[model samples]
Target: MSPHPALSEEERARIDYLVPMDHPFDFRPAPEVPRYPETVRRNALSNHPLLRREAARHHQLPPDLVARLAADDDLGVRGLLAQNHPDTPAPHLLRSFLEYTGPERSHLTSRPNFPTEGAGRLRRPRGP
Candidate 1:
């Protein structure tokens, strides 16, 4: 059986509302930087491991939830944590990315938000 149960359409849609389809990185515009569905905010179970893992991608997921997700075993979620964790939330996991030897490490290097010290290339020029 799949370790993470398949998400239903509605569930996927809810996830999308926070992390848009093409934008992909749990992104926000930096000042308002992260936001999520009201249900996610209000639901007590929002901190459940799966929710924590999914919400970690949003620039806006609360620090507490990010902590919970980091504590989970899902490497993909940690990859999201590496790319997303704006406001400098998870320092250790960010360091761990360099130690990880998987494709997910790309999250740290490729995302525009990665710290300049860790990023390989200069800021990308605008493209059309």
Candidate 2:
């Protein structure tokens, strides 16, 4: 039986559309998924981390939602915003890089605006 039995067929379809089947670390959303700004914003504000994560992966995610998700309590939501959303601020990307040890860690470094010069300050000194 499905874990989320209450999910309607449309809800299940939305999940299937957003969640990639392969290249889990890829920044790009599924090309075939239709843009739905209202739905994306709704998901971004969802209390459930999984729903927030899905919203974070959307290519057309609204700027307001991006800002909101950047401050999300769930590391997964923040990390997905940093990884997938082009408009994610550098601060959020840096925070995600520092906090998330996910497979996409390296990719965050390559983002156009990801800060590099002062990154050494973020690391702790080795044992004396």
Against the true structure, whose lDDT is highest?
A: 2
Q: Per-residue lDDT tens digits of candidate 1, residues 1-128? A: 11133554346445523322222333234445334455444331342344544565566656666666556565545555666666434354555455455544555554544456644443357899
The list of candidate 1 runs beyond 4 A from truth reads 1-38, 41-50, 88-90, 104-128
Top TM-score model: 2
lDDT score for candidate 2 against the true structure: 0.73
Q: Could you give me the TM-score of model 1 versus the true structure?
A: 0.44
Cα lDDT, all candidates: 0.49, 0.73
Angstrom error at residue 27, model 2: 2.6
Clashing residue pairs in candidate 1 are: 26-57, 34-60
lDDT tens readout by residue for model 2, 1-128:
11143664456555633333233434765559676777777677665566777788886776788889889887777888888887778888898888777586888988876888898886669997
